[model samples]
Target: MPSMTEPKLISGNANPTLARSIARRMTMHRGINTNLVDARVERFNDQEIFVEVYENVRGEDMFVIQPTSNPANDNLMELLIMADALRRSSAARVTAVIPYFGYARQDRRTKARTPITAKLVANMMVEAGIERVLTLDLHAAQIQGFFDIPVDNLYASPVFALDIRHAFAGRLDEVMVVSPDVGGVARARDLAQRIGVPLSIVDKRREKPGEIAEMTVIGDVTDKVCIIVDDICDTAGTLCKAAETLMNAGAKEVHSYITHGVLSGPAVGRITNSVMKSLVISDSIEPTAAVRDAPNIRIVPTAPMFAQAILNIWNGTSVSSLFDAETLGPIYEGMYSSQ
Candidate 1:
């Protein structure tokens, strides 16, 4: 149950469609007009970001739905500025509903003179008057420690698992999960255990940050329907390469479910001409024209999940159970217990 004070939903340019979908879901649950709040989030002549709230938000719980993707800096500024505006306007509480948290990949300092941008972003959010954060599928789970306020990090696996389950329903035994790199083994293993399948890893060496080396399949994938699970797919080189390696190692089909589809550079082009069967991404970062036009790409809706999460956070309820295998309604069915 939502609180008596209905929350205000605001949107930035990063992902307006997702924001609107979330608002629509909120209205469906609350039975009220919970559309996006009237606000002006625009840029100035000098490319300065400015946010002006048109409607009254005094003492109302505010939600800023912004995903810092593509043009990360501008979108990030919009979130900070919006939070500042809401705080200045005397909002009761401000929660940042960021579906795709950018700069999360830089959670740690891998080398000297490198900055932990993830922590910096967290600090910036708090300094801008954001009281809490609600985001999905962060690149690094440990980044939550960087935030001073409450951070609810949701997983997109449940949404993805439902579709995966349907695709492999009676043929679940032939399926196997694979993590393209060592970093995603936990994510892959979770899904593997969920659907009762084996796990595989793609062991590859990297010469540099943007350069990938030859990959080797760490586990057997003979005659298996391999499901590659990952967080972000920026250039998608690793994704496509891993799919090829898996197929070469005798995988019947290779399907990837990535949480955030950054899809920069020639990502869509590579995916379009890759050996992978399909690449299913969530509606986290607003789909670009290339993404929408991709032949083998699919999108799964996560607005309802986010809307229910917002409602739970507002009501001070358990947010973890929403991803729980046994508790998440008929979507999980009988699988997802070990995870």
Candidate 2:
């Protein structure tokens, strides 16, 4: 039986900084010396991933922090292997903490003969003996149905709402939340509601993969500063084109707050040269050198929210309360009040 104590945190090579940050927050929140379980993840000569848990995890609750980001295959394999190792080590329960769920964009098939890799990933995790899953802002909410075990899909809206409030405290009236595409209107509308702003949508057509055909602003954005919101920003093509269209529609400025900054391809270059006033993304995926060097890019740390979620899950408390913007508003306001 597992002891009624703090959960053991093990980190993969995917994003150690985020893991460490979560550990630190856990320690502070519990007022105890919470430390990461020592583990070595190395590669063989042939580049096969190897994970060895150094400490005894028998009868302990283990939470492995690994984001399936860049080199998605490698990180995902590491997570699967680590879960297997922990299960074999007699861990009572294993929770896979995947901050950025890779391959989630393929939750459904747009055409025939397409594979739902998201469901495949979920099956792999279950087969690897993951008792639960903790992730942030899944590309599709329905992806939760892919897993049989408990899955907590944490949202970044609370975090983004706080940042948006701080950045435009006195002039929120001039702000408008925009969904870069019609599909993201719900996500953008949530943020807009939280921040008490009107919502707008960008009607876009994609001619091919990773390319935008046309973008048109759906709602009135005249003279208002637009803040485009979405779950992920991959190539930056859509975001850039939307910003341009919004500008042409008489918007004063365009900014963006995305949950996952999967800034792949020419994303950094596009954002740097685009007309966006600022682009803020959560550090769900570890920022690359190019991302960090981008002048218009800012990364919001997600450790605090993830840390709280982990703590809640371990304690068998309700994690849904964490998503309550009303409750989180005052807390975040106090947190950034001095900054």
Which runs of model 1 end up more than 4 angstroms from their true locations? Answer: 325-339
Error of 1 at 276 (Å): 0.7
Query: Tens-digit lDDT track for model 1 on 285-309?
Result: 9999889999999988778788888
lDDT of 2 by residue, 1-339 (tens): 324856989999999999999999888777987799999999999999998999999999899999999999999999999999999999999999999999999999889999999999999999999999999999999999999999999999988888888888888999999999888988998999988999999998888977778888888999999999999999988899999999999999999999999999989999999999899999899999999999999998888788888988888888898897665554343656733
lDDT of each structure? 0.89, 0.91
Poorest lDDT segment (10 consecutive residues) of candidate 2: 330-339
Most accurate candidate by lDDT: 2
Question: Which residue pairs overlap in candidate 1's backbone?
Answer: none
Per-residue lDDT value at 161 in model 2: 84
